[model samples]
Target chain A: MPTGAEWAIIALSLKVAAAAILLTLPLAFALAWLLARKRFAGRMLLDTVVHLPLVLPPVVTGWLLLLFFGQSGAGGRALQALFGTTLMFRWTGAALAAGIMALPLMVRAIRLSLEAIDRRLESAARTLGATAWRAFATITLPLALPGIGAAMVLGFARSLGEFGATITFVSNVPGETRTLPLAIYTALQVPGAEDSVTRLAIASVVLSLAALLVSEWLVRKGGRHVL
Target chain B: MSFDLAIEVPRGDRTVSVTIAPASGITALFGPSGVGKTTVLDVVAGLVRPSSGHVRVAGETLFDAAAGIALPPERRGCGYVFQDGRLFPHMSVQGNLTYGWKLAPPAQRFMTLAEAADFLGITALLDRTPRTLSGGEAQRVAIGRALLSGPRALLMDEPLSSLDENRRDGILQVIERIRDDLALPILYVSHDRAEVDRLAAQVVELA
Candidate 1:
């Protein structure tokens, strides 16, 4: 059983993960669709860039984010000018880092599903008077539902586990940027915080396991029709 | 209710050139496998771009390469029933049947949902998913879906090849009714001589 403060930390972690998923979902789906369907110049380059975060060290990814989104950095300064807000050392910054870390998984899951779709069905839709957008909305999107669901769950799980990028991008701050992993790290430095660490670790394992089970179920469901 | 197509399409290392002009009835494009018979239908349906060609259907110029006019598949109003019957697996038979009908303009719609279902003998299968349907049942639903879309023409590619003899005869009767009663221009593709003879008003061979 976690104390009230610990519970707050858990809640913050969930909020960050949820926000990260929301932020990344649409962009991930769009990139996935483009990568799966189109043939164009620099497609391979685009694919490599998308997968860079997965292969690169979490700290490296975090450094890149910080470089681009730091208070004085171009994106950070532009965002400040446009929105009159800053993400430095904030929960929103944690979400940005988590989302970037989770993006590759989301895009990969969605791209696989999109590629698996029978393009002939889209052709059928077109011949039946559906426009390109309508065909994708009706036929392609529905068929890719299970994969999209799996992508969301996988992304959420990855976001929940995200530590290096979040810490590097937004230094841990209690009740603000202090999510589960950061809280656990904070507890680890104390000599008598073993019990707290155990509790948090258990919660993290349970959340990750649940997400994996749900993703697996979605993949199985999608497999029946997605050939 | 006619088609005049003169097109050349690239296929791998080779190119397939074909010219077809059929007026007001079923015209069968008969050929063995790998002869690019289906490619011709694809060209007419605007699924494939021709290197140099013109496609005129029902007095509308669908594609004119020289003039730089190419109508997309949706705008062409071609009701194409593919070889495998590509029914949307997510939707029920009723949903698939009405997908095109819902897209068509109200004034252009000559057939209602119930009428199409009744015409194709698929009224009973409307609530079922496509996965539950037999081959013949799926084909009928496909045909029904195409007809309900208010198309000026139809392109069927080996629509009956997958069915058994009994099921084929059943669909054959339905097709005959479509030819004699509905009077829509049809571009039917099949390699079977007997099937072509039974259905086509004119046969064009691809060699």
Candidate 2:
């Protein structure tokens, strides 16, 4: 039973998480497919770089994102020049940090499913007059749907829980960057705000539980098709 | 020539070299296990790159190493029936059958879905998924799928090896009708002497 203001925080959190998932889904799938199927130079290095956010401190990842995506940074300058937009201290920036944090988990889930595919089916597709892209779209992509679903759910949950990276990169701003975790943190800093903290914590736990249940269902559905 | 292949492919520590020029009809590449019989089919289907040599099927030059011309498997229009019948598990039998049919150009298509289904006796199983099919039924669907693609040449790589003897004879008969009625060039690979003798007009033994 969150108040209207608290509900705004919840809505903002969902928006950020959704945006983060949308931003990372394609890139994560591409990287996952490449890691699972191909043998290329620097593949190991690429894998390590992808997993850096998972192993590195969230603050460090946030620092890296800030360094690259800040207004004065090279990437930030390029983005500004190209898109005439800045992510600095914006909800979009929060999403960017959340996406980077959730990427490794998404990529790992997708890569495992991609690797588990029977590559021979792709070969069979090719011989049946399907182009390389067609084979992947029709055979490999459909077969990996379950994994993709799981990845999205896991990524969404991770994005909702993102605190260190979002706060470090975007800082706390009410109604914009003040998502669930940031709001909870803000409540914690103020005395006599224990009720707000308890409500927010319950909401967070409920959201995470819902995500896990969906992910479990997706895995079960995927298991039936994988064989 | 229906098939004129002289290819050398690397296989682990050793290399496999095969040369066969069959004019037409069923031509079987016979060998024991591990003799790279399937490798030859793979090379013809453009699934494997040959170190040196050329692959000409149905007057079309598919791969010519010296000339630096190698058509990919999709462009080669080779209908390959694998040993295990690699039917897409997620798709229904009808979906699998039409996968290739949908890809082929309208003018190049020689057979319709219904015709192939009728010929292969798989009309009843079209709605079912591949997981529900028996080995022999799956093989029939595989063959029907290949034929409906309207390929210039067919490559059967031990398609009957996975089935029991009773099922094997039934599929063998279906293949015979395809040979006699369709008049399509076929490259069949098998180690079974009796199967080869029954199907192949010419036998090319591989060491």
Candidate 3:
């Protein structure tokens, strides 16, 4: 049987992953909409930049996040001075790292959905007295719901399993931010802890599988709506 | 209702200029493909801006290049039906019908939600999403959605052009019923002379 601390780690991991997904969704939608609909200079560059995290090693991404958002970093110092907020070695930093890692996945899913939308539907809405923003809210967004749902599920799953970035940014601190993946890594490192490690590993696998199943269900639902 | 439009658009090497004074009933812009028939409607619908021209629909000046006045599509009050029925895929039949109804001004609103559904015989499909609808059924909903907006004029650009002969005939009947029942003028675009003959009160051929 798993210890209470192990269960707490799993729950905390789920919460952090859910938070990451929730935080990134609106930003993903905005970026995806811009990519799908707009034509401008630096468009290709922006696309490549957004996809950089997906291509880079997770540790490298986490390292970069720490450089930009750590205590000594430019924005980090300013944020600390202004609001006394600190991201380094904190649960919030874990969420930040996870969200950054998950952003590309969310954006890609949403962009595909946004691209699949019929431009004629938007035109039809405009003709029917819907302004551009109104048309987007009432027509474009609803049409793209399936894509958004898929993105959220994928992002959340990715966040839950995020290890390299989370450890690099916030480290593994129990009762604060020692998420499931980190705890699993810690358990494996400790001698004579095979049973605990096995429990945590199984928990991680089950959570990942469940998330994937949910994602599949959402994608199928979305596909039906898109058609 | 009356509409006056004079616009010039470049199509490859040729510049298509249309200057017409439109009166009530279906005015079909009959022409071959790529003759700028769709472009003319685009200008009227505020989808395209003319190099030098003006558009006045039912005494309301929709566009004037001289004065740099151009109304957006939302302000044009022209209900457009495209070649494909652009019903909201996420919305049920009733939700799609009500979308345009909500946009119409209270005084301008002539049809209620139930009335619009009844007009299209889509009362039963009201709760169903557009993906489940057949092509003919989708077109009927599109027509209902457009009608519910209480448009000053209706612009249909080859609305039945994608359907088969049987589907086309079915949609044509619904369209005819709409034309007879509604007082709004319609600018119907098509390349098919038979369809033009079937629905148009006046024909304007574009080259």
* TM (chain A) per model: 0.98, 0.98, 0.96
Docking class of 3: high
Using TM-score as the yardstick, the better of models 1 and 3 is 1
Query: After superposition, which runs of candidate 2 have C-alpha atoms over 4 Å from their true positions?
Result: A80-84
lDDT: worst 10-residue window of model 3 chain A: A218-227
Pairs that clash in candidate 3: none
Question: What's the lDDT for candidate 1?
Answer: 0.93
Specify the poorest-scoring 10-residue window by lDDT in model 2 chain A.
A218-227
| DockQ category of candidate 1 | high
Residue B96's lDDT within candidate 1 is 95
Candidate 3 regions off by >4 Å? B10-14, B164-180
Model 1 chain A worst lDDT run, 10 consecutive residues: A218-227
lDDT of 3 by residue, A37-79 (tens): 9999999999999999899999999889889888789979988
DockQ of each: 0.86, 0.89, 0.85
Q: Please give, for residues A1-227, the per-residue lDDT of candidate 1 as tens digits.
A: 98898889889999999999999999999999999999999999999999998999999999998999998899999999999888889999999999999999999999999998999999999999999999999999999999899999999999999999889999899988999999999999999999999999888998899999999999999887776
Q: Give each model's whole-structure lDDT.
A: 0.93, 0.94, 0.86
DockQ sort, best first: 2, 1, 3
